[model samples]
Target: MGRRGEHSKSEIECMALEAAEAIIEGEGFDALSARKVASAIGYTVGSLYFVFRNLDELIQRINGRTLDQLYAGLIEALSDCRHPQQCIYALGGGYLAFAARHPHRWRMIFEQQPRDDNLSIEIYQEKMDRLYELMEIQLKALAACPEEEVFIATRALWSGLQGVASMTIGRKPDREEEQWAQKLSRHLIGHYLAGLGTTQFNSRVNQSVGRLIDCPK
Candidate 1:
């Protein structure tokens, strides 16, 4: 007989995540299903449902879990750097590395689209606020920049990360893409640090964010 698995519910959730990640890595999210996850972990589909009300909830949970991991890694990457510019730079590099290391999990977060007033949306907003707080701290440390400038620059910095991460996780980026991602990440951060080319940068980023929210809901 096969060996028994971990007994705790949380442990099963973790295992489920592991299975989900494998599915993502192998075939992308479009191919994911409870049966696949259940087969991966030797659990039945009913057993999986006992933990997740539906696939959306399971995906949301996975997104939340992976985002926290990404946040922790980025924080660790920036901890040793003193200058805010360096912190932001390290943040971009760490962000790319994390995405590469856990491509499917990273993609899920990048592609998530939660419905308004959903519990998962609330959770997502809370996490977003925390990330924004980190950006605020970094901005506060640099240039004595005004609140408006910081908001503009922060959006640029984050959107650039998202853009680069998406390329890396796409259908096999070429060598130029790999090299350009590094160059692009650094150049993008530098662009923001260089005053976003003007205070107007914030308004521009806001408009763009408002128009093109491809990153799920």
Candidate 2:
């Protein structure tokens, strides 16, 4: 963010981006506007237009900041874990805790889907991939499955975990929720990894019976 001997355009843009994120955190996206942002940072609305063409561009800046923070948290969580099991647990806990602390930021990351030009969906999915890569590497050490399957399963597991996390943040907080949240989330993550260790579901169903009424034999 430093340039030669003075403040660069990049530095100004970074300030605007951070300001926008703060605005979103203070009030929902509906409350976000060029004028509001400018007022918050003691800049005129025209100044914001210099860095961003419109509100959408500002939103993109917010998304980039969100991803940057998410990646940092993930790296820090996995920094000390030597075993894959510990790494996986840290990833899950870190993700949930992040959502809990920054509910608005979490939604800002996923609410509006990013454009698929230079930054394809794969780019966003890459974040999930990095997290799952740890699990897959560990799985390969003990399992005999194809890499593609592992990737797909890991994605599904993350989707499930993200679902619970986002829901917990969006829904009103409940004191009774304390009874099941930790156990439920942990069970979801454990089963996801444990699912990779096996291939059979051991379903006990009457195949002979169908979804039909017995009108006539």
Candidate 3:
């Protein structure tokens, strides 16, 4: 075990977070505890308290890191896709793959309710918005809809993907299950995009008809 002063405060904090993640990933979030994390890092529980205000803060930090990782995975999924629609599919595939790979961490992101501090809430919202922004960009490009429509579509598509994952992904999802989830995601995206295109087309036609009716004749 390392002495308390051997590692700087920041290093201790990083070590604790990594240890906590490993515990959660291996044994699930319910298995996480300060003492376990501390022991894993060759430090005392008091050492963890020194760097984190409480266990809640530590969990929040983990959630933040998970979000950043998820965002990066989604970005990587977009690399080979040139079209906006293709990018959206890639995003859905990436999301499901991440959830399947890190089932416990992914579940913790939604299931764990962090303490409601303003700073924490702000930070969480910013991280969530970054993910939503990825979908919004693709939706706007593909749908060519109003900003309000694009926003709604972004959330709607994500909600659908989340639902698909929740229903299909398991604690240790197999390749077959993962493939099934991907299939559902593609179906959902295909139909949703088709409906969006139809809606926009009908709205444009209605506006044109209204304009013609009101013109001087």
Candidate 4:
């Protein structure tokens, strides 16, 4: 048996989280257990409890990290786009690319809920709000609607994009799925923007419709 005090509690916690993430990424969350993580990190299952309250807490921690990474990826996707519409499209594409690349972890964020109400209230909401704000800013800039309308529009557009991702990015990557998702995203966003612009809002619809019409089959 290894000495208990060789690694600090913080070190043990970090090791446990890293090991657990690897397990989940490689073999879905159902396969993860405190015992497996402990064995991977050279610690006893009791050692894991010293850091996390239980497996539920551990899963929340992993989801939190995944959200952080996703936020970073979305930020990077916005770098090259100048127009608000372009930025919004970039955001959708970035979200899809991230989902496809990390399907398991991505699904975990939306599908798994933390058992701790406090943790859910504190961490999950904040990260999700940050993500919404990315799309919210673009919508606000693109449409001159009331704040209330902007809020509703953001939710509608994002929900549409989320639906596209959910329907297309299956557990296993299929090239056809990704392509169809990308097509649907651009098509939906283009038409939605066109409709919003038609309301004589302060936003210009731009060439989205033409682009959609010209899109390859």
For each of the candidates, the C-alpha root-mean-square deviation to the true structure, in angstroms, is 8.1, 8.7, 4.7, 5.7
What local lDDT score does residue 50 receive in model 3, on the 0 to 100 scale?
91
- The full ranking of all candidates by TM-score, starting with the best, is 3, 4, 1, 2
Could you tell me how far off, in angstroms, the CA of residue 108 lies in candidate 2 after the best superposition?
1.2
Backbone clashes for every candidate come to 3, 0, 0, 0
Per-candidate Cα lDDT values, in order, are: 0.71, 0.63, 0.86, 0.83
True lDDT of residue 196, candidate 1? 35
Q: Estimate each model's TM-score.
A: 0.78, 0.75, 0.91, 0.88
lDDT of 2 by residue, 21-117 (tens): 8877777666778887777666678777777767766776677667767768877887888766667777777777666667677787778555644
Q: Per-residue lDDT tens digits of candidate 4, residues 1-217?
A: 3547998888888888889889988898888999999999888888788889888899898999999999999999999999889998999899888888888888898888887789887778888899999998887777556678888888898899999999889887677888888899999998888777654532224433322211111
> Which pairs, if any, clash in model 4?
none
Worst 10 residues of 3 by lDDT: 208-217
Please tell me which model should have the higher lDDT, number 1 or number 2.
1
lDDT of 1 by residue, 45-142 (tens): 88787777777778887788777888898888888999777888888888877776776677777576655348577558777767766776776676
Could you say which candidate leads in lDDT? 3
Q: Show model 4 residue runs off by greater than 4 Å.
A: 1-3, 201-217
Model 1 clash pairs are 112-216, 113-216, 113-217
Q: Could you tell me which 10 consecutive residues in candidate 1 have the lowest summed lDDT? A: 208-217
